[model samples]
Target: MKASSGYAGVPRWVLAIAIIGALFVVLPLVAMVVRVNWGQLIPLITSKESTDALLLSLRTSGAATLLCIIVGVPMALVLARTRFPGQRIVRSLVLLPLVLPPVVGGIALLYTFGRQGLLKAPMDFLGIQIAFSTTAVILAQTFVALPFLVLSLEGALRTVGTRYEAIGATLGAGPTTVLRRITLPLVLPALVSGAVLSFARALGEFGATLTFAGSLQGVTRTLPLEIYLQRESDPDAAVALALVLVAVAILVVGLAHQASLGNAGGRQRLL
Candidate 1:
């Protein structure tokens, strides 16, 4: 061990900076928790509209996450494991929704799938009116949340090297067999974590859902929308709703963290 020149090899300034940064990050959560009025929490949550919005939020977000899994897992495989001309561009395009403003995303969806949109005639012929409906809520949530699943799964794929898959292929395994048996199991934890996080994000979504789905009661009014509307008429009720969202967010993120850590630990044990 090296001798310290009265500094213990770690400057007090650095420790202070770290503590300050941590406090800054944690203060808002603390504030929200402290501000919540616990006395009326249950009654506030039991309000008809609040319950409706909460259920709608869960249903739509869950549906959107299912859609993400159906579409995103394959795309993640392509982006992480394959190569072609313009491959980098294609990968970047997948992440565009994450960085884009949600309202702008809503407008983009409107232009592409709304009434009188590019495919409007065919969609109308098929009796598919996508805007301002429960279906629209799912679409808006899926549009914003798909990238999260894709990106997380891509990272997991990168971590899980292709060597195992190549060896499986040499062992008389077909592409489908290798993917179903080898690739999916190895990446499942990431996929699950991504799905959970995406569901939480979609549940808390506001701008795009409002713009595309139109806050119709019991149809499209999700928890966030209800909270926004309630703020104008009942501030206490809004705070209670906000607390619920905060609790859900915390639980989701905590589960994601635990799941990711468990996966890493399992992988290490296997190695």
Candidate 2:
């Protein structure tokens, strides 16, 4: 396509570098796919351990997605609409986990929610133990995944601007009405895209979940953790599990791309 578009301005070295970068990303995935045991793929991933991890991943990730949406949408709205002291700092903090190492984030969660940590007395009195539990898995997933939803939703809110909201207010609509009727519909695509990205991130989460939730089989052993364990003695099963993740990643990208296209089409229709 670049060649067909009359890309005469591009230098040979630039194209070479671009191809090399693409190869770096594509080669490893291709290797995984190529090495997959085609005949035993089904049996490998459907085994008890595989099924447990896969199911746990889906459940925790789904819970995390819901948590992100609930908390993240409001946070995004606040960031996009409000002006206050240290606003930049708040925004940075909201996105801090995105750049922070997963293991580091897990430790942070541990400090905040662990038995002997900040909320220890409150949790202990209530008989709630978060760390090293399935609940801990969901909590850790939420910690790492929240930023994806927030950043995407905040961008969406800004792109939507405040024109419609202002008009609605001028016409006697309350803030809640405007938000429910105008702002939400406008940002629906972004919401879906963000949620998909968050779910994918949670599904692939490893370091944080491992540190916070522990790899207890049928409890906290998610797909990635399971893949790591399988690699030691069951390379074929690991490959099969890895393929499952690759398929999920592909689906997530496809959904986000489709959402983008839908949003573009919606704007064209509005125009």
Candidate 3:
């Protein structure tokens, strides 16, 4: 006759393992926070180099997020709404950056845009250079962050399905009309979540930007790169910057989660 606590049914071993997993992820963050030189935290993170890197990271990551949305949304729609030969392979390739090492992705970008790369002749003819520039930093971030948007939006599209789309067609709505009015509105929350996640990923990009763009303060030296450089000469500054990065990441992740919850709520209303 006793009232049950929902979690009481979970096995003790499972609960213990889950607690351990949470601690494993959390303890390092706690340790870093403990290591911070609190008295110098503001000064360390407010230095010229730190501010420059932080600004450049924000700029490039913003550009990268925009680029991801411009391209990733269409890619998601194609993957979710259509069937074609080699579709699985294409999706796999599109999502490759999610699993590939950042350094490897940077290498691939280098060979595609470097002076001696495949398009070298055309680039030289056009008097354009992409390597080791702010553009390169943006491209590197986009390369790695694109998959997050694509994957998120695609899953949402699949879950929402094509029933409403078909009905729109029967009601004399054209494809573009149906898409702009019905499909996009239904998936707006997912799109926001994906875009925020892409921004976070781009903000944290390091290995790819370093390998392709080369760190130059106020240019290609993003916060992550700045943190790495500071780690060699000023551990306090490095830790401070790392904490800043972690805070921004946490904020972005919270936004994504809220957007996801909104999407779930919207679906329930639809039901």
Candidate 4:
């Protein structure tokens, strides 16, 4: 295809960088596929422990994702739309977990919420024990995954703008009504993308989940934790579980890409 006069302004390096970036992203999956032993993959995937870890991964990751949406969305709204003292620091802090080592995050969680830690008195008073429990797994996942939701949603909120919500207010729509009828639909793609990213991260989370939640079968042992344990004793099962995680990560990226394309299409149609 010949470039239009306007399109001729695009630089060749931009295209080269994009191609390189795509290959970088895809190389791991290509390697995984090439390394997979198909004959034993199904058996490993179907084993009782594998199935339990997978089910636990799905359940805990799903719960953590829902918690992320419920909590992170409102925080994103505030961070994107509100101005206040310490706002810069708060925004940075909100994203701090993204930069923090997952192991450190788990240690931090333990220091704050572990049975003998800082909040132990109050937590115990409430009859809630955090460490070594399924709830602890969810909390650890949420801690590590929440920032993805907040950052993505905050970016989307910035793009969507508050103008529509203001218009809704001018039209006498209540805050809840305005959010549900105007803002949310506009930011839905971002929310979905963020949620999926959080879920993917949660599914693959290891260090933090292992440290804070502990590896207990049918309880806190997520797929990543199980895979790590299996890698030492059962290489085939480890590869099989790793493949499952890879498949899920691919699915999440695919869905995010499709949503973005759909959003672009909608914009083009509107234009």
Q: Residues 1-271, candidate 4, lDDT per residue (tens digit)?
A: 9664432576777777887999998897788777778999999998989999999999999999999999999999999988999999999999999999999999999999998889989998999898889999999999999999999889878876788889999999999999899888887877888888899889889889988999999999989988999999998788888999887888988887776666556545534
After superposition, which runs of candidate 2 have C-alpha atoms over 4 Å from their true positions? 1-13
Worst 10 residues of 2 by lDDT: 1-10
Each model's number of backbone clashes?
A: 0, 0, 0, 0
* Residue 236 Cα positional deviation in candidate 2, in Å, after optimal superposition: 1.1
For residues 127-198, write the lDDT of model 1, one tens digit per residue: 999989999999999999999999999998999789889999999999999999999898888988899889
RMSD of 2: 2.5
2 or 3: which has the higher TM-score?
Answer: 3
Using TM-score as the measure, name the better of candidate 1 and candidate 4: 1
* Ranking of predictions according to lDDT: 3, 2, 1, 4
RMSD of each: 2.0, 2.5, 1.5, 2.8
TM-score of every candidate: 0.94, 0.95, 0.97, 0.90
Per-residue alpha-carbon lDDT of candidate 2 for residues 46-132, written as tens digits (9 for 90 to 100): 999999999999999999999999999999999999999999999999999999999999999999999888999999899999999
Clashing pairs in 4: none
The TM-score between candidate 4 and the true structure equals: 0.90
Candidate 3 lDDT at 59 equals 96
Q: State the C-alpha lDDT per candidate.
A: 0.90, 0.93, 0.97, 0.89
